[model samples]
Target: MKNDVFLKKFRQTIARYDLLEIPPAAGLGRGDKILVAVSGGPDSVALLYALLEIKDEFNLRLYVAHLNHKLRGRESDQDQKFVKNLASKLNLKFFSKSIDVKKEARKKKLSLEEAARLVRYRYLENLADRIKAQKIAMGHHADDQAETFLMRLLRGAGGSGLSGIPPKRGKIVRPLIEIKKEEIEKFLKQKGLSYRTDSSNLLPNYFRNKIRLLLLPQIKKNFNPKIVDVLNRASNIISLQQQYVEKNCEEILRLVCKSKRKNKIVLDLKRFIHYDISLKREMIRLCVKELVGDRFASLTTSSTELSFDSIERTLSLIQKEKSGRKVKLIGNTWAEVSGENLAIYSRKEKQYNYPISFPGKKNLRSLGMNIKSKIVSRPSLPQKIKSKGEEVAFLDWEKLKGQFRLRSRRPKDKFKPLGMQGTKSIADFLIDMKVPRYERDEVMLLTTKGKIAWILGHRIGDEFKVTDKTKKVLRIELIQKQK
Candidate 1:
């Protein structure tokens, strides 16, 4: 690979993905800060040099970041030192961090690779934020993409996993994604650049190593000589298809989604059940992606956390399990069949009990809702007011007895809904109304004299209904607060 060829390919990948542009119209073609993740290996070292060669053309301010996982003891330190020295030689800023990946793996109950990858990305992202970098560049190339595809394929991964490595994900960009590993090494040699080699990569202990050193070679020798190119081509096609699927999934998600919070998503089960199985699986993946605070592309290609079995279990919970049943998911998330809906939540649902003040507004933080209570005289009410939705209720004020409080439902709670004869259990009423079980705790109740006055946003109790004989009415309104 000639110097000009390597640079041309690098620029081409950037152009194809629009990598350097932050907002497309930002004219970020020049004077952009970039943080380059360098591991002192051949691929990363080549990437740094390649970017450095074109830095002036793009008017780029490049910074180098390295994480010493400390797995190889002295070798890890040497790797960090090499990266720092390279950055210094290039007259660029350098940042380095050391972490005991084995210790972190044990403490976090994760694999060594998982722990190291997580810590490395966190340090890079934080450093990038601190430096106000517009882009974080990685050295993932064609060979890595093919290996990733094979690994995921063997693990029974779906479309998302089979999509392979992306050229750009969020602020992370891979300029070498289209370049072959062999071409990268040739470029380094042609440029007389030296790079450190990790001994661990030669060992077949890790799954990736097994694929790179063992499986891939065997396939190339016995199967197709150009297996890497074949896999890469397939991944590119699948990636395009996956992007289209993701777009459609997002549109469908809007229809099925009932409520979306920072760490929770409630889906209407009645609407969800009507979708095809493929759509359902993709929707589940998208929900997990949102709950985990991941960019869609990042989760789709690189994440194996949401396994086929985990998604299947969630689907089973939605289809077969009784309402209120939940299945645990990755990243401290849970999927529960809540009556007429399915809820994916990262945090535990909490119960709220608070005092209600008349003629005042109260914010319910737990429910992300607000309650406004006011007393209105019947004579002052409009003659032909528009019919109110479930959020508004008119109750006879004279019938109210003890102190008023807004709280969640308790066990065996019963209320005589307006226009209904006898009392019905709160649980049964919620079921009959098709309210999700996860939302039951969030349903506010206006209670006085140890009796339910209204199921806020649902129904007003029979005892508190406004009538012709009533002179004053307790008007309560429920408002959903923006998260």
Candidate 2:
């Protein structure tokens, strides 16, 4: 008789969750490739061996991907070599990359741990795309989930944040999510497998490390010995409740949301104010997430730090019928009440006046854009050129006086909008355009001789509009800065 109880348990877990089976809604099949992230640690080593035991049963192809965050000098290299040898022993194809995580941290203005995580995931996604992998496998386990829950709890997280790390998200799957770290170590020891350990993990330099090395053990020693299990159970219960709430919230959002765009979301106040206060708060959180994109979802370590204060402030603005009232939010986002609609949008940074070099490009640092100006003869212009967007504007070269200045709207600024009878205040123009009051200050204005020529992304001044009598045209293009 075979003695493989651990392997049997692993298989049971996989089957219980249908980890290997392709969901009916998914576009791929069961035989597609899966990418496994191996960090040469005990948890990942156990995960790799367990998956290898069942690879043939599922008819799945396995590829190992490792990222060496070059923070440990020689030790990091040894870890990479260890993982490579392990992959070779298993006869699995391996892909590896090394990145200077400290340098990345400085460049991105993030902590070393955050930079490493971001770089590691980006590399995994790119490799998966290159190899046509259906899913990416991670080694996070129950102990990690417990630690995450405590961290979020200490930070006063709501239901969604208290749910802990998700076992499955998009194309990423955690095969060992329900397994304990001790169980992983037991499996590795039983199989006589060798793995490398990162010394930095022993240090309390990062918040998660502090929780793992200090707080968790103290909690277990002073309180329940099975605190990890208790936390994991609570996470499961909360996750189920959150899922139900989120489903209902999505339906309510669909009914009340007026519009959803790349960086902005609008919801009807009439329909939104009728929901219960609890659902109202959830609705505001979801709208903020939609406006700022999913990346902002993880802006805080707890992953739900979109503080109650911000949401309450926004709700108050909506209740007061203050059309132009707004409240700033985390992750450079804001919520404003505008004419029976709640608008959530990203805030643009303030910009100062900068003189534009004729026939040259000038960087708009605050807006993440560049202005390119060029003068060309009227005869050289395309005859049937369609407007690309409001970002690009053409003006009569002769109508311009001295060098143009790019700046924000002044208090007494006035502009002659194209096809308009007379000049109008910039404030009134923005109000008519429905631009949120808080964002109006960041709108770029191209002025020449103290006269408004173009409202960057909206309209061109009537005096600068190109006409048949124009001898030459000055073309100005606003190009977004690529990351």
Candidate 3:
């Protein structure tokens, strides 16, 4: 009867989270392959058998994977061997790798546990990508979730962290997340299945182990006997609350946002400061996430590294009256306060310089765009005299002379903007236009004979503006090339 309940709950957990269901994005589909992360422990062993029971129903092609941290000498090798044998016995494909967790920990300046987790997930993701697997399944169970909640709670984590281990994130799924460790061990016992144990788990050296070994049992005996269920329930509540908050944060982001690029995100300082303090922090977190999304291997890992102290430090830096100050953020990113904008970016942008030819499209490699220039007769052009959009500009062709070159803004650059009688410093002009300081470096200028003709994607010089006397019109178009 208990064995039946275990299997029933296992399937229910998967269904509840849509673990095996087809996702909206290019993810799991019917009869798709899944990479199962099996460490040969009781939790993993039970997970493998549970998934096997539903293999035909889901049409899943299961592949077992194991990562040996090599922290336990012969024991690590034995764990790998056991997983390989288990996969062979089940007639499933197996993948395994060995890494020095201690060495990696020292090199990456992370704890042994953190290093092991990072390296293991990277290996699993790479293997899944190589084999074209649609999903990667982990063996994290309810007990692990409860422990994670306690750990993060102790560290003063917010709602995002308090949500605990997610059932599914991207291609990584934890079908066993709703199952408990004791239930897993009992399930394996009922099936007469044997599994390997990592001896390090018995030692109370690691904080997680200490929490699992020392703290949980006492709380269960002296306090709530169903602490795991309590924590799990709390995590679900927090996750739901966080989802709502994220939607509001996204809406607020659009309002305060100045600009966003691949590696940089700029927010309007004037607008950002007016919002409630909590909203400001959430907006900063969103900016960090946008900039660091591609930098980290997984979303959960990035969330864990986004510490409260780091967020507080960023808030402190941006709130100060001083500009040009920067603070380091997680995932190799940084936050800076530059004039009227707060910039969160990874690295400095490079300068761009390229030649433009008439009646031809020149691809600006650094700008990731193509600038097409052509001469059209006034009769052939639209009746409108001024530019319709920043991307498309029209100038008096006869007034311009010599070849045009597009380059990054220079320190001494000045331009007489259209409708302005006198020339103004490009730097002051951009500042008056409310362009972020960091983004000013990326602004390009189209110059002819050492004079600014137009600021690409922004403005056209007064001298280049088309007039009624202009017979020929120079049409310049900026086209963004697909990545």
Candidate 4:
């Protein structure tokens, strides 16, 4: 009878939020073990108590993770103690990590707001992974969802951003995403349960707090009292559309970038030129990220929008002119038109190719190199030029820029090094290579661009090196790990 009452009340609440029609939990499989992130706030306390109340129904094994971002000093410590004591009362396993949030923020070069959230999520994610928990639940209620949606919307976030807080995101789930913050407070009051409030939440300093206390109250006063619910509905509708677009993006990636052998993603410009603007922008940006990760392309995401400017332009020319064209792109990769093959460099990697032809599945750190190759039957190349300082890959001869340029150091730089071999002093030969001593080795030799045009003590075999009669292509990969 107690379980029946709990279910009836829960169903009533779900219906009030119009979440009664929410899809079954069969997809997420909440499973038995659940990790909950508790901040001792009213919402979290309600979430914790509700989970405990319904544990038997869900067959749940719950663990609590908390982050002590020591920004409030003693007050923060008190919050931590308050949470620990409650966990003790509840007989729940409690995990806490004391971190200098300010220091971390500085070290990560992030704003305090961004860094705190980042560290908190990192700790929670690690806890979930370590415990092998399937869902990491949080206490974000509908009010929080509204704030996030408005914030992202103001920031010019597209549909993905407007989707707001999802009920489930990877291992992280907000089980109470449909619950209002005040209702949680009411639930706690009815049960005579007390919760600790982070005083900072009331301050106008943080954008979220300002939204919660100032903007939201103003909206309720001027417009409607149910603004949060209205925004929540808006976010849900946006989420549906966002999911469709995301699904299409995944398909686009699979189609255009499937054959890329290495971490680099090569775009087939022909196929890509056909996509509409929205998908084209996303596909192009994803291609850049897939090949080079986040560090490459564009200054700021907001200002730069998509990092596909160069690639998009190249595609435009290909579509507009129906001819061969080439453009240099961020992250030391190139988008090129050669014969019938329109390609985005799948091998945008830049690693030291000190010694080429290292065997497969290697950790050849000693060679100052990290590259890979699949030894298939030797495909005929347009030309065979060694890794001259200005050459990294065995590319088609026609692609070569026609002039061999090498970069390396020389004091009074004089050398009759190979090909231009003669008793030219280090000064004269370096002058010939037009490379400065400081940048001679680390100049990252390329065709005036930072591509792997050469590796010092190697060959400057060629650039845009493919020839007219070329038949096959050799794929080379480079890796420069940031993590």
The C-alpha lDDT values of all candidates are 0.83, 0.81, 0.83, 0.61
Off by over 4 Å in 2: 1-3, 22-30, 291-305, 319-330, 347-415, 419-434, 438-460, 464-483
Question: Stretches of candidate 1 above 4 Å error?
Answer: 22-30, 295-304, 348-479
Predicted candidate 1 versus true structure: per-residue lDDT over 309-359, tens digit per residue:
888988988778577787766656778887677898775456667777677
Error of 3 at 141 (Å): 0.7
lDDT of 3 by residue, 436-475 (tens): 5666766889889888988887889988788778899889
Candidate 4 C-alpha lDDT tens digits along 227-298: 999999999999989778877897987776534533334456567667787886666555555555423311
What TM-score would you give candidate 1 relative to the actual structure?
0.76
Instruction: Score candidate 3 by lDDT.
Output: 0.83
- Distance from true position, residue 403, model 2, in Å? 18
What lDDT, from 0 to 1, does candidate 1 have? Answer: 0.83
TM-score of each: 0.76, 0.75, 0.75, 0.64
Clashing residue pairs, backbone N/CA/C < 3 A, model 3? none
Model 2 lDDT on a 0 to 1 scale = 0.81
Worst 10 residues of 3 by lDDT: 294-303
RMSD of 4: 10.1
Candidate order by TM-score, highest to lowest?
1, 2, 3, 4
